[model samples]
Target: MSGVWVWVEQHDGQAASVSWEAVGLARTLADGLGEPVTALVFGMNAAALAQEAIQRGADNALVCEDETLAAFRLEPYASLLSGLAQERQPDVILAGATTRGSDIMGAAAVDLKAGLIAGAVGAELSDGRIVATVPVYSGKLMSKVTIPEGSPQMLTIRNRAFAALEPDAGRSGEVETVAPVLPEDEIMSKVVGFEAAEGEISLTDAAIIVSGGRGVGGPEGFEPLQELCDVLGAALGASRAAVDAGWISYEHQVGQTGKTVSPDLYIACGISGAVQHQAGMRTSKVIVAINKDPEAPIFKLAHYGVVDDLFKVVPALTQAFRERLGK
Candidate 1:
């Protein structure tokens, strides 16, 4: 059956959490479009990872296992996927918006001339057509785009945009072995040794994020923010100003140049929402902004707002939450 084809992402030979989340979203889109879900896994030994995809609601798992595919490089991975997509010709193609993933989507779209959508918040099927919602204007506005006269609509979903589903071992799905049509001689880029970035929490996958901005004053002001995040079990993110001020690292910066986070809860502390910062976090499920200025742009989009000093407010809120939870 022609269906929604999703790429199951794995990093460093292990299945990544974002892949599971993508499966959940694929299930939703497939159901809405009245199509089965077919997943693609490519690696040195992605067979084991393919089995995990079945439990995550895939109707069939396509495996392309080869030793040459051990590491992720541009040429081989892209050629293999582009060939599979051409022959399979599914109605919709969905991939995660990660380092390797984005690269694949851009290349595949070029090869197939298919419509590509990035950072999709949600997708819907209406009048026998697929329409998707993506953030625009640095997350200041949301646009629902429709891909017209396309063979297969390609969409790259951001991480943490949807909740993961429970795995049911009782339910088993089909698995198919695929051979790469493209030969190794045609591949251009070669794989080299890899290094993993060090971090306490990956901002993209954080459920709750506590973000600070220029209003925090300086590096010393982050102490309260950090304490509050620890109390709430949340990740700490920062705006460009805070990072530029040497209050935090660029990795913690939330903006166009940094990571995009759509956490369940995003608490903006002492921040005056700049367009750049909003670009990263406007997709959050619920936004709570705390700043001394009531007119801050963040308050306009925030579901809850507190116009007060973050130093005083953060500690009080933390205490209240701990007390309420009987911690």
Candidate 2:
């Protein structure tokens, strides 16, 4: 049990992509520490996910299955993880920097008195200690931190910051079912229903993103952007200004206040990049900017840029991609 552990987040009986990514990183860390990688899964019928975890590089899967654990409630989940950590004394725990992951991990860390690193993009073992690199100052700086000696290190990594390992169906590992230690009354919160979002790929999982800004004019302006996104199989993103202007939901916003995305390609249309917006997407592998203003700040960070009206440029680009991709 004194090894690396990943908290696998699942929804609708499927594991989150970030869970697999964390497994990949945990495998690397476990290899360096000469320890086994264990994945902790919680949900009803979570046995399948435990086996999936093994195929994704985990040596062991610790599953907690119960009707009460079907939906994610903070207290029960956090208490369960804390109890396990106290009993098993894991060397390191990794979780995705998602809303639920951040909440549960912080509570568990407080209970275990462990060092927690949030929004970590990279990690390594140095001098028998786990060191994590986290972004600071709107992604302008990276601060490296190490947990105190003899304490379990807890880290929440950003989505898309690490790649997931390919699953090998032939791989096998141990799966152990564990019961929750929390009392019935201790589980205070209850989930009554679920609501699904409209059709759109999550920005974190998207390989390509098409984003718009104030220059998009209004909510209607997103139409052309959506068309372009559809053609390229990309997600639609919005600058903070656009979101604040009520042109789009905050979920699609990308900035310091929004989600961080490191897609393979990012297309900024009519956006005069602010530092906050760039901080969220500056890590993208490739960036293309289209703006009528040649002095737009976004152009400085773009690998390719075109100074023109987006209304004309975007449609043309969409048509061209559609013709070439035949989609």
Candidate 3:
């Protein structure tokens, strides 16, 4: 009756990477709390995903399968998950702060009357209760929070905030199927279509990222950055300045108001390193900055820095990487 639960979000019959990452964190929490880690998977073909959950660190899995649950419709999915929470009475629940995860968790919180924390960067047990460290004021400060007594603690973590558990084929666990109890009238929304972005890697999932800023000069300035990204097999990112100037699409922007990324390596070209911009990518493993201004704040955060014109430095760096990579 008392356990840590993770919501496994899946897409195209495959589990999302963030869901695996959450399971890894849940494994740690469950161990600390001396409880089992349970994964809740919901979709049309969720049994396979449930197997993946066990391999990725879950002690057991609960799968809910139905045609209406295939594509994420808020009402039915929330109703099923919230109903399960009421019946199973899990102690803590964790989910990724993705579009689908956020929507479903928010609705479930309302249905179960649970205390919810959004965008938690870290979580651990403190004196027999779950405490989470959450970002506030655009990542300027972190606040530790605990759910009130008599409530199931729920948390939504940002993508890439934690490392994923490596899947092991040798691992095994139990899987239980839960029938969906949805009335036709309760399912109000339907997903008619889904279109994926063209020729772009997800920023949060990319190991390497090449980002441009205002000093890139114009839209054409991104050409060199793109070349470097291509050579490194990296995603392309932009600062809010470049995005606001119409030099790049908003989808490519990395900032407080934009997407957050935690790549293994991040190369910032001509970016001044505003607090808002840094908030999104500061978690990256290694930061490299190239700019003419030696006084730029980005240098403070960069592990490696070059004080030179980005126009010249970027192309030189690109050509050097191309040769080194045998591209």
Candidate 4:
């Protein structure tokens, strides 16, 4: 009831950008509610991340850097977070809707018996409670959920839904070190190996994304899209059809069954933009569709449409962008 809290997620000592985005949202909500923002850091380099959290927006930070907390193991991390929330009694808790973020939040919410609003696009203070705006029915409709008072309101924010504040180097805040709630022996799960995709920007964190679908043909079809992605310094994405066709890996799929993305610009090439696909990228700031069929469903939601063969248009666009960018 005293402060607003943000969960700072990190990997290999580097904090995820979405974590800072959550901190930014927490700062705004905290200011409005007249409560301080406290960032919770539970991993390697927690102290440094705690300071960066303050630079981003938090008023203070609570850090726990035990060996067991070094890598993200669910049981220990969630137990620590839940215990802290129960003891401190924060008004609200916010986290990025990444896989790890969502997992930890859901587990902690179960422990605390608190209401959790997942993948919220917008939030505001209403009558001393938090009202979260969430997309429902495959992004076809939006519903608002208001968290009641008494327990800490929890929300997982969608990526790119809100803007992050500029960091101020001079900004300073208190960093409190805390003990891990669970012992290493009591933690059930273990992280055996971590293999991250090399050289590809994560779709969720990409500012711009270029996606391919059924029109792209086979695995070789993704080469053109890769060229465009390289030219634009954007992430490469695919629809479920393309993924199922082996045109691209499942990691690149963007749809209801794939990763949700809200980039500044989303370019759909050879994609029909089915409702399932729209569910993921519908919240993008700008959308462009290119397909031979003018009647493609993707054109319905696109801000700009190109009725031409992707083979002819994609290469032309890539070359134009390369020359324009001098790359």
Candidate 5:
């Protein structure tokens, strides 16, 4: 592991957007440290993605194509990544702070005894060590974490925190085929199947989101917000209180205990902007809060505050957007 290593997260041969962002970060860090960027890709029939990784900025790629890795099972993925890290001894490892990326990286860190920085909003090489900027105390403050000079420095980058470089289709690099570290029979766990959420945008990848809270009143109260989301082509999200109240599923929860999001625009309806919820979406580029309570905490941090009833306001906004966008 003499080079800067980035684990390119992929699904069904398509790469995650954050994987490319991590590559962009890796390219910058590698340039500063005078190291080559090496991408590690694993999945069934992921050779094309390996090539795409090179086009995105990796100097070379190590690809592992196996049926065992077709679905992300922790046992095989972690075993393969950790074994490779031990053998190659990469100076640094980067991955997206996605479910699979975080899972495998955490396991690899334990196996290799490497220092891992999770949920890093930004990072740079300082004094030959990685200094990662992490949010703490529910986004109220930023904490700087420095990985000491030892073992491989690993980091899971928060989505949208770094810009991905435009791919150069003409660029060429080396691609090395690798094998899985564990045998199928030896692995304890297996991926039975996947039940993906349909017709909904991923919160981490969404550019815009329309979220509801306790203020939405009940499960049916989310209908107006859903309409708004449809008009905006945005993902529907919810505060923990709404989720706890059974108004929405946990998958739609956006808070410290749920999925972290960093969208370009976040419209919070009937949300009180609790610190817990803020931790998940405080990084959104533009925050708009629509609450009847003028003194709602969400108004304090929102770029635009609409003090009104969300039921009334949301429908109006949806209709306006539909008319304007010609939807």
Candidate 6:
């Protein structure tokens, strides 16, 4: 029978947070569809990991294990997963819009001959159909799309758009193994060396972000905000203005072309809040703007606004937070 299935991605046997996030989103969708949430785990040592789906609210977890599956491989994963979906006839399949997730989704979509939607932020299950919300035109626009005809409708959602769900101890289920899943010889992609990023937490995963822009004067001006961010246990972010002006690295930029963040709190220091910048962080739970010009567009969307020099105001705010949070 058809149900909501989440593709769990793991790295070296460790579960990816994006998979848990997908499980959370799938649980909501399943609740609306009045169906069960089943996570599909494909990798080695999956026995110890199946409990995650149940603890996180999945009704059942479908495990397909292999030693070769310990690493990500586009060819075998796409072949195996799409083949399974065809056999099981799931109502819908959801995955994170991570680089790797998007790769697998695209490959599987072609094989399944199914309609695909990327960067979905919202979903609704009603009238025996799944309607997905997707952003368009570099996030300048948005639209709702539905698959009129498909056995397993597919969608990939932007990370952090949905809040991660806490484990629900009351909800428990079983882990079933999908028979004859994949063999090492059948897998095409092989694991090479991994260059893990060091000493930097990406803005996409941060809960709090302290961002600066061209108005911050120069690259050196970001120091104070960095200090504040460090004290706040937050990540550093930059506007396109700062990045374009060569004041900050593109990796630090938050915009349509850069990373999109829906942090718990987003503090903009001297940023003018261009459309692109807003596109990235407009969904933040709480927004604070520290720009001298009250006329700046940033204040229009900010929950809190200060019309003063950021150099003076930001330090004061930082001190206040440090005194309060003792950081």
Model 1 stretches with alpha carbons more than 4 Å out: 181-187, 190-193, 319-327
* Model 3 lDDT tens row, 157-243: 887788789988998999999988786667877788989899888897899999999999999999999989999999999999999
TM-score of 1: 0.88
Q: Please identify which of the two predictions, 3 or 5, would achieve the higher TM-score against the true structure.
A: 5
TM-score for each of the candidates: 0.88, 0.97, 0.95, 0.98, 0.96, 0.91
Clashes of 6: 0
Candidate 3, which segments miss by more than 4 Å at Cα?
Answer: none
Question: Tens digits of per-residue lDDT for model 4 on 146-247?
Answer: 877667899999888877888899999999999998987898888989888998999999999999999999889889989999999999999999999876
Q: After superposition, how far is residue 34 of candidate 1 from its true place, in Å?
A: 3.9
Residue 259, candidate 1: alpha-carbon lDDT: 81
| Model 4 ranges off by over 4 Å | none
Q: Pick the winner on TM-score between candidates 2 and 6.
A: 2
Candidate 3 clashes: the total is 0
Tell me the deviation in Å of residue 189 in model 5: 0.7
lDDT of 3 at 249: 96
The Cα error of candidate 6 at residue 107, in Å, is: 1.1
List the global CA lDDT of all models: 0.83, 0.91, 0.90, 0.91, 0.91, 0.84
The whole-model C-alpha lDDT of candidate 5 against the native structure comes to: 0.91
Model 6: residues >4 Å from true position, as ranges? 179-191
Models ranked on TM-score: 4, 2, 5, 3, 6, 1
| Alpha carbon deviation, residue 123, candidate 5 (Å) | 0.6
